[model samples]
Target: MSNKCKTAISVIGIVLSIALLAISAVLAEEAIIRPALAVTFTVISAILVFVAIFYAAKIDYETGVYECRKCGHTFKPTFKAYTLGAHTLSTRHLKCSGCGEKSWCKRKNRRV
Candidate 1:
């Protein structure tokens, strides 16, 4: 599948998981669902959210390379670094492999 398609699916999964969790919370607060069942639903929804987020992170790491602003170098970060690094929607704080400068690097969909 295309990267865009994978990304979209992952995003949708996360959204659905959160929505399920919210619904469960509302049901429990309103006394519409049994407390035990609501707890079960909440746990299941939280697991789903974690799985979805992990999948999304995997897709992001696999599909794109980060470009260092300092040296105009493009590289793929280690999964640990990718996960731990601070980021905005399209940029991540990373140390450039070539220039050895730490900065917010832009994400590029193009292959490394």
Candidate 2:
């Protein structure tokens, strides 16, 4: 899939999750819905958030490469490392395959 499409899907998923949570909160606050139903909606929204995160992570791993600061090498990390390592919006703490040093590596999306 294209990067833009992937990004759009991820954003939509997160937005939908947030909207559901807000709806649940409003329903519970106004007593418009049963408390049990509101609780169910909250749980579903939480699950959706998790699912969206997982999908985004998987896409990142598959469609992007991380550039190591130490050796300037670009490589894909193992899924385990990708998940376990600390990260920011644009970088991840990872061990460079070229230099065997850990650093915050910049993520670059690979051109399709």
Candidate 3:
């Protein structure tokens, strides 16, 4: 998966876990100490930490078929990203690598 997707998922997981923990704690009455409650809290906290580590970082670039303004020849550019250990994501960018020209579809397929 892309770094953007990982980051998005991690943020969501953290938010939901915290919210659930807060709600459960507030619902407690008379400060009852229960073994199950402690277990539940531990589980949630662990999940939150795991997600935070997984997301880590993200990088991306794009490439695409383009008409070289100077040479009038079709060219291509490729996008790439690095994140999550050795994982990577890449796709064609809408720009020419040969002559640095812009393609028509430069706006499409933006990485999440």
How many clashes show up per model?
0, 0, 9
**How well is each residue in 1-112 modelled by candidate 3, as lDDT tens digits?**
7655655676776677677666556545435657578667757766765655443321222211334445465543442311211321322224445656553322223424
Q: Candidate 2: give the clashing pairs.
A: none
What is candidate 2's CA lDDT for residue 46?
Answer: 89
Q: Score every model by TM-score.
A: 0.92, 0.92, 0.33
Top lDDT: which candidate number?
1
lDDT of 1 by residue, 1-112 (tens): 8899999999999999999999999999999999999999999999999999999999998998999999999998888889999999999999888898998999999653
The lDDT of each candidate is 0.95, 0.90, 0.46
State the displacement of the C-alpha of residue 89, model 2, in Å, after optimal TM-score superposition.
1.8
- The sequence of per-residue lDDT tens digits that candidate 2 reaches over residues 1-112 is 6997998898888888888889889999999999999899899998988898788778778888999998899988999999999999899999998898999999999878
The regions of model 3 sitting more than 4 angstroms off are: 30-112
> What is the alpha-carbon lDDT for the whole of candidate 3?
0.46
Which scores better on lDDT, 1 or 2? 1
Using lDDT as the yardstick, the better of models 2 and 3 is 2
Q: Candidate 2: where is the Cα deviation over 4 Å?
A: none
Worst 10 residues of 3 by lDDT: 79-88
- Model 1 gets an lDDT of 0.95
